[model samples]
Target: MSRFALFLALPLLFHVGCGAESGDEDVDPLAGIQIIGDDLSDIPLRGASAAQVARFKEGDRLFDFVFRERDGLGPLYIRASCAGCHEGAARGPGAVQKMVLVEADGVTPAADQAALPYGNTMRPYGVGGATTLVQPEDDLVLKLSQRLGPPVFGRGYMEAVDDAEIERVAAEQAARGDAIRGRINRVVFHSKKNADEAFHRFSEGDENLIGRFGFKARVATLDDFTADAYQGDMGITSPLRPSELPNPDGLTDDAKPGEDVDVETVNAVADYMRLLEIPKRAPADPRGEALFVEADCAACHVPSLRTRADYPIAQLADIDAPVYTDFLLHDLGPDLADGLIDESASSTSWRTAPLIGMRHSTSYLHDGRARTIEQAILLHDGPGSEAAGSVAAFRALPREEREALIDFVRSL
Candidate 1:
């Protein structure tokens, strides 16, 4: 059954009585529906065909494959493989640090990053004896932003969400009196060869496509996301991104010259991400769910959005994906600002976090500063933050009610 159908059927399937025996008699809302566990993120989508499952397995192997210097593993890079940052297909210990050149105020970005050749990414490690650490010039003032790797499971659903749905949500939020307006993050299509792989709404000349991936939502397609990571994070070039980044050694190529991996490899990994399933949610506390909406946290973290019917994957097509994100950029306020500029996303702006796998996540927020879900919520309030009203509402709730809300969110 579809998740939407299952969600709607849950209350009717299990009955709870008023007496103490209700606890014992209550049925499992998700019983036989999903496999709930730590490794759930690693599992493929239900009802995948044999060919799709084979591709998923191939992509899984590639995702975990460690690249060495011979395999084009960088003269300057961050990690050797995708799994280095996204361990277990979820948030891992790895973190990417971005150094933004700023003015005297420390918040305003410098005119440009000409002083820092490697751009904002601080790739401290490298191979081929080009081990000279990248450092800033004496005159340049810099602000460092550390971004922990986000969970990768269920992103295919986000990719499949129709552009119209996002636009509709944006229009709805704009009409609201609350200060919770969201803006679509439009980014240019990077790879010409892969342009045809974009959603059907996009044309041959389309430049600024709706970005649905990354913390800044700067990437539009899952294939591009995979190709970008292979090159940017690992310095392994593919057909999509064939050029090597500038390094201290001034090297223009790696040991494996030309494209390190073929388009097929990139597609395989992208398909794997597309096929990965979200973790099964535990039964939610009804009161807690009600309190979450009461606090207005649902304003930005929308409960669900429907995917496009034409999406190539049958499982993801036209489904109500309960990813709990609007997939639009919003100003989170000054306190959470990182002073880093990414495409159209300002330093203080962040894409609404998807809460599908929150129960399994070890960290919270874009930078992973909050260890606990409650801490994440408490940290939401700041001057000029769109979430200020919601945070205030949450704060005013009684202790039990607050716990209930947090518990409900964690259950996602």
Candidate 2:
């Protein structure tokens, strides 16, 4: 049966007399629905051993390797190392970068608005001894912007998730009607090889596909994203991305041939992330779980997805993914627009982030603008406006209930 149909078939009154029943009388509504202990337990990736751990350490060393002016660091890059942006607090693979704004000349627009000659993510540090000024023939001109962002953690399980499951979640949400539509955000896959010579274009056939990672759902795979970080963040080159950045400006020498970096390093980092377990749930989390569904947060943050058994990792093999998300991009309204549109997503659209391990996350929202969970809840609008309304009802509940809900999120 469809998930929405099953949800509708279940009695909402199950919570009323659930705990009062004797063993022989009514079935516990929370029985099968109870948060599974296995969900919070650490699950390692397949074939991971002490040797793998040693290799991962080697990958960490590679991650910290700094590029010199001769090695080609960045003509346009963000940070010097992945750890620089990804470290601190239970950091996730998805980290945000910050930069300052200077002056620029590009497409003319309204005030409080200007276009960067290249794109967002202004690099604060450039290769040593390079001139900071843009050449006269450059496409556009802009200065730096202020710093913004922090790193997040736990990404390997995210990549291990079967694409079918993400589609299933979206199907389940759509079946619930337009009141809670969750659309998947299609993203570019950097590692995908173009069959045709259309590598630069954005097309469904361009080897690019739906995005499962990033706040905006931009990247396709952990490997692809890590490789991008190697080049864009650290100014390193690999086989998949061989061209070296030019000296001084750190611009890529497009005219030159590319080189290959060690694949083992990239693989180890991906393995480390894939095996990283989700945070454990708190004792009070069950109450929070009940409140999460009752509050309609599950409308978008729908939980309990079954993963494909064929996944490489034995721990994630044929398991139920308790990660709370529909994996869909929805309009967040003008209040949160980044003025950038990717593939199928609009300027105001953002992927519904998985709420797993949300308890460890302090800053909320895509831009990390909301300081607390409550503020994040309040910032919802558009398709998620109903969820925001649900939060309001949740707040009206007894203080203990609110605490339970918070506790549940921490447990995940």
Candidate 3:
């Protein structure tokens, strides 16, 4: 379903009403965004109706539910509940390793026969026992990356963004005369329950659709993302996806097929992630903004994007979303490649992680190796790296300027 993809978000193309209302020279940059608050846990969007708020609570409860062996716990899974790895709705490590084994080249993954179920995700914690699990091969892997789970915040805005906006940004970036050419991950989204039964998916025209969620950007909608997470992460099944994971141990799963949990549980969990609030940020620094732009960081990390005016939430509708991301996939270079070409995203390519609520980030990058953001910044040295120039620019700055720039990023 997902690996620890950093806040996967991109630009919103909405215009603000006016600057006079917020008493600032420019319109409130963060107005209509997540309301500033101390608590960083999942919260409802601004101007949410009473019904919406109630539903948010329901979703939050479902997100917090800890499943047991009887409560549809995985026949062969990694974690039990959504909060098991993502404590407090924030990103964290998983029980079993999210392994994506491939050849030394890392781009061409072997066929399913050579790379069985065990090569993908390592199920260290199975409900039944070791006999009913899928473990990794000892020597088959040339490259294996340990993935962390990303925070599930501000995903609704991402879902509401128009596919045309993503295409427009891709064209604009290509026209800028830069090496940064980010393409959308076009995926075939399936129906809630079955792929062939009923599938009027997220396609703009053809069977393929622009994906916006997950580490590899393989999923297109919040509902599908949630279902995949449930099936893959927790081994829990629902009407949407009613099947146990592959058991390479050649043992019985003991769990029946068809369905494990009801459809309401799936929707509730998805809804919680959808209505989740944006991260809180410190006051904006104009100098930092200028420095961010001057360093060419804004080339890929767009400053502002807009939600559709007719969006569901009053607060999110037509509001200025200052999510600093282009939402397209960019190659971070060989140094940071995962060697796993999932769907359309290349081994070195990753979606532009949204910089909003960056203050709450526990670790940087997909693997959570970079303790500090600076280390993460310095790791961008791949052949297809779009941030190479920006990284150079950041390094060339004076100590104070560099610190100031970093502080500005922290403010986001």
Candidate 4:
């Protein structure tokens, strides 16, 4: 049994081992302890309806519930539950290492993945007699990248942003003539959606939609994002993505036959993501805010984007979301490139990471290699990087000014 299975079974053992009278009551020793508000990363959005609150609670429970082999955890898997990688709805220690065959330059991806069949994702664990794992071969692999799971808070507002708004930002950047232009990541929709889902609808025969989620901006909506994580990370199939990923033994099914989870569960999880609120910002230094904009850091990391007027979530609709991302793809140049192509995005291209909860993070950047915010900023000065101009401006600042800017960003 997996650790999660053991955890879930502990409650049953307690119930069976002890028989307390219905009238018996035990007093808690620490019931009067006051709650501290330091960690509000998993709280729901302001002004949520009672019904919305109920759904958020249900989704919260499942997000932390761990699945075992009998629950279709994996013939192959990564972490066991949503919370495995995103503990407390924030960045956890879980990391997925992606490897692929690249060209001689060690930057561009190979023409095809035929040489390495298990695909880019390298699952670290296996179950149900499938012991072989996809480890990187030194001779075959040209490059490898480690991606840490991002926080899920305030995602509802990000998902609610209109495609037109994303396009508007892209167009403005293109017109600026500053090598900082960003483009949208158009991707195919693979998840089920309600007919009246509040999002831009694609015309008949058009499969491409603007993507805003994921490192390369590959996932278009919260529901599909939830479904993809369930299948890809946990190896649990759902109606939206019913097929199991390629495994070593060529196994087509797991311990649980057919789909492991139902549509209701998927929707519940997505709704929970939609209702999560971004952590409130601390007071910003006026000088630092001005310096941040002057240094062009705000070019790709736009301070705010307005959500659609008709967003399904009442609390999230028609508001300026301070996510600090334009949700467009930008090439950070060769030094930061992971050498793994993702759909339309090249190896060096990445979506501008949001800065809503930077104060709570110990690591920075897509791979979490930068231990400090200053180090992450210096990395933007890589050769041929789009943020070169911004980094240059930041370097030109006085020592005190630079420290001020860093403090403002950390307080975000």
Candidate 5:
């Protein structure tokens, strides 16, 4: 059965227990029908072919698989599986530490870092006793940042958003002459990691690709994201990432190194990620909706977006999904800065985090520093961020209206 149909098949009487609802009380009509992460973030979107459904199920199995040294886990690595950092398929308790040497300006990453611990990521775990944790001796001198694994939901829709549309929004924001000057982070691409392998113009001919996923938009596609997580977070090399890096311990259980996992395994996992459903938006209060617009939070946290009709998924094509993001990189001020340059994204720049599944997240921001949504909202100020006025407007709201706004955001 389709995901939506399964939800409708449930008896309606099950919901109207007590004071939570009246006879017509409205929750997300499709609340409980999930392919993965029941009551959480990893549901599959509606309208999958039987074959697609099978792949999604298989992918989920692979995503949760734990690897050992026999499976070529690591000579040098961090965890053993994909699910380790992103347990429950939600924002990470699996924190990825990034170390970068800051130059004299204190914003750009140092050009030469041969003396530093490792490149960008630090993994502390390895196969048995074969791994030494990557801890820099100059921990104070190097700008260290913790990257929380973001929830993997509704990414297919985000992938379907046309590049022209993203550029168009950037132009519109530029035309507005406001503080929100959002830019794209362009990075490199390889064949195995490009989800649309034959499609990306750069992937076909050039190697330069536009960045879309991750806190700094360092990754471009779900396949790339999966491959990167496999190698960087788990120390497991797949066909997508054919080689392993030298760990701090310089240990290896595998005699020969080229391919640890087959390409089919990586592709299966990517397929599952490709279909993850966007959590349904909580019903909005009219007053909170108006305040959201009034506060100019809508300027950056755009409430709705349309996907092109040509997108692969039938249910997702040409749909007006409320994704609540412009997907461009913006500077959220100095407090949020980490000095880690991700491709074109500067140390101060971070992708405007989509608020689609905000209710499921207990921690907020790239580093998971903000515990409350309100604290996160207040952090959106500084020289380059355009949300300073919006922050002031939000702070001035009446207590009831403020709670209403918070409730509205949580509903997403």
Candidate 6:
């Protein structure tokens, strides 16, 4: 059968069963069931050759690279290395950081927003001298702050996800008349060429795209994000990003002129992240799986999505992807909005984070505010309020059942 046909028939075959009555006996809705066929945890990392491994080792090295005053590790920046922010067990992309700002400027740190109530993961390293390098004439005084985040794992498949599948899931949600709606976060592909140039040239009328990376979904691709991190996070400058983050505050000589880092190093780090394998699931997570589905979490946290036939990776080719996400942005209600708007996402809208490595994560939510999975589940609201209700129903289940749901998440 055609893939489209199969999708069209799913609602009929898997009817939305009636919600259990308030005090009914608990039933296992997903017993002996197998829905998705793809295994995202098994894909191999490219560039693992001996030399590649050597470079990967260097990239993984905690913080040996040096920065110069001109090369931009900040008049103001965040952590010194990717490892600094993303460290520790159970640390994935949803890491948290805390920073305090006493005054306001044109750009407010993401954590400082009164509405958001989270902390900013500020850069620990600086350039020039660690004090204000701004001309004596300028009257801007900003304080240095600190915040931290967890490590990100199993992200390659997340990037490998086909855009079309995300759209299909959104269409399905709209068709079902469910309150939950997921939207893709559009991002700018700065290097994307337009048709007029030997490569394509971008014109004024061309539609600006949505970013699919970062906490706010501001970056587009892993390569771009890596380059950005080199410049913004670590104070390194590459060919792609020639300028350094300005250092109005002269904290170290590293921020002085003519300080540039090698681009190949940055690429190597990105390659390591891209090739890092997804963690495997454990055997004890079946009950959790059942509860996950029964709680209607499957509506947004889709279990399987098939990759398109024409992708570069041979392993990912024609496989059923079980990353457990629809990859669409949804309005998470007033409580979650950051007041910062992107092209396709509103302040309240956030991408449905892929749950490929949830078991390995300590923090939850975009800002990493929820310390536990249960807290994160309870925080769901707005379009996802229905799913939240379903979760509450699952909580009412016997402790074993609840544990099963958590086990299932850990298994993933």
- TM-score winner: 4
Q: How far does residue 228 in candidate 2 sit from its true spot (Å)?
A: 1.8
Candidate 5 lDDT, 1-412, residue by residue in tens: 1222212211321222122112123344333234343455766676676666666666766776776667777766655666655544566556666667787666676778776655777665555566555545654456666776688777777777766777787888888865777888777765444444432334423444657888888777777778877877767777667667666655533533567777678778877777777776667676887788888888877887787777666777788767788888988776678888778887888888888788779979887777898988888877666678788899999989998888888888
Choose 2 or 3, whichever is better by lDDT.
3
lDDT of 2: 0.54
**What C-alpha lDDT does candidate 6 achieve relative to the native structure?**
0.52
Overlapping backbone residue pairs in candidate 6 total 44
How high is the CA lDDT of each candidate model? 0.78, 0.54, 0.67, 0.78, 0.69, 0.52
- Model 4 per-residue lDDT tens digits across residues 1-412: 1212212211221122112112124233212111247546777777777677677767776787778889998878877878766766777556676777888887888797787777888776778678545554546744766787788888888998877889999999999977999989988887654312444454223467888899999888888888889989889888777888887789888999999998788888888888888877777666888888999999888889988889888777898988889999998998888887666888999999988778767888887778999999998878778999999999999999998899889878
Model 5 CA deviation exceeding 4 Å by range: 1-39, 103-108, 128-133, 138-140, 191-208, 249-257
Sorted on TM-score, best first, the list reads 4, 1, 5, 3, 2, 6
Q: Which of the two candidates, 2 or 3, achieves a greater TM-score against the reference?
A: 3
Residue lDDT tens for model 1, 169-194: 99999999999999999887786467
Superposed model 6: Cα runs more than 4 Å off: 1-58, 62-72, 88-125, 130-150, 191-210, 246-259, 308-310, 382-389, 392-398
Q: How close is candidate 4 to the true structure, as a TM-score?
A: 0.89
lDDT of 1: 0.78
Candidate 6 lDDT over 1-412, as tens digits, reads 1212212211221121122122123243221112244433222244345544443344444222333345455555544445444542124321222322333441233444442222233333344445422112233232231112433455555556676777788888878765676666766664222211321233323444445566556665565677776666666666556565544442333534443555465556655555555666656655677778888788888998776565444445566777677767767765565545556666566666667666556677765667877677777754434355665676688887877786677567
TM-score of 3: 0.83
lDDT score, candidate 4, position 109: 83
Q: List the residue pairs that clash in candidate 5.
A: none
Q: At residue 236, what lDDT does model 4 achieve?
A: 88
Q: What is the lDDT of residue 29 in candidate 1?
A: 24
Instruction: Please write out the lDDT profile of model 2 over residues 22-136, one tens digit for every residue.
Output: 3223243222112345452223333556555444444444444444445555544445455444432143223333221233322122244333344344343455444432222
Model 3: residues with Cα > 4 Å off, grouped in runs: 1-39, 93-96, 105-119, 130-137, 192-206, 249-258
For all predictions, the C-alpha RMSD in Å is: 11.3, 14.6, 9.5, 6.6, 9.9, 15.5
